[model samples]
Target: MSHDNSAENPKNIDRANNAVSWDNSIRLFLQQAGSSSPTPGGGSVAAIVAALGASMTSMVGNLSQGDKFAAIHERIAEIIGRMNRLTGEYEQLLHADISSFNAYLEALKLPKNTEEEKTLRRAALHEAALHAIEVPLRLMESCRDGLAEAASIAEECNKNVISDLGIGVILFEAAAQSALLTVEINLASFKDEERKRSFEQKVSALTQEIGELKIRALEVTRKRIAGDMA
Candidate 1:
């Protein structure tokens, strides 16, 4: 008899559907997310939120194009390209978040009847948990970078869509906070104090920076929308 080993490999797991959450419509994604399954939880939701922020940034960039805005057309084009790429990266992070969590679930199911089996299970769980943390950390980093790009284009994008840039910053802020919570939860599984503290420090700094960027971006957005940017 031949045995299949697909389930043993996290990369081989079926992520074809959930990875592209927007392709099936947000309604369907929300339905599945609200189901009893726990795969597409906070982490996946954060990725979607961040992606929406990037999309909003790109939307503003696209609106800022044309001969009327020829003075900064090249810079706006570059911003649009960067925002589009960030959107794609966030979508990929959705897959990574789901897979990493599922990998932890698989590790949890490993045999623990003997000392050797228990040792192996512990190691697997440790690795899986770290990966889970890494996914959210990456999401937070992407949110920071995306917000920076959004802020950069806030004053330069079309005045008609200035509010959209603020909306993007708000979304990015929420996603970063959500991802931070996920990272904190995963950090609970770590037995090494030094390693865990390192992650804590990193998340703290990221959260602070994200918050500052949100404030700056929103200020620009408000000033532009109110015609107060003298």
Candidate 2:
């Protein structure tokens, strides 16, 4: 009998530990999300939503090709590349959010019976809490950036797919808003006031940017669909 040790490799072990793939059915994911499990929670949902938005942006770009669009072909190509990159980033973020939450739970389990233990536990908790906040913060930032790229080509893309770009921007806004809520919830329990305020400022700016981008993108989409931009 041959014994296999490939799974024992450190890199493989790490991958197995941190893996959070969502390549399964949407219904399966939804069922798991709706279950009692705290994971695949709001943060993961936000990340996936952002991924879908990026995918939609890429789809619009792909459908907008032709001699009729020669002038802005380069711009559409650029938007597609950026949206592809954002889609990959959002997939990673989905895993990061779940892992960060799990890390916080592990930190909470750290022993705190003595003064030294309490100090160590507190440090662990603070680090975990910060990681949790950072994951969602990155999601918010990515959504804001993705929305900008998606909005940039909204009016120039194929008229048939204009609505998709609009829907993509809306998804970006929703994801950013959801990520913002996750960050704020974590901040509520966070101990560092100065850091909290800094994060809050970013959240506020992103909130405004996301909302404005959605409105502008959708307006372009509406105009094009209604033949006003023709």
Q: Which RMSD values do the candidates have, in order?
A: 5.9, 8.2
Model 1 lDDT-worst window of ten? 1-10
Model 1, span 75-108: residue lDDT tens: 8888888988888898888888877766766776
Best model per TM-score: 2
Model 2, residue 208: distance off in Å is 1.0
| Per-prediction tally of clashes | 0, 0
| TM-score of each predicted structure versus truth | 0.87, 0.89
Give candidate 2's root-mean-square deviation (CA, Å).
Answer: 8.2
Worst 10 residues of 2 by lDDT: 1-10
Error of 1 at 97 (Å): 1.0
Per-model lDDT: 0.80, 0.80
| Candidate 1 lDDT score relative to the true structure | 0.80
Model 1 steric clash total: 0
lDDT of 2 by residue, 151-202 (tens): 8887678889888888888899899988888887778888999999998898
Off by over 4 Å in 2: 1-19
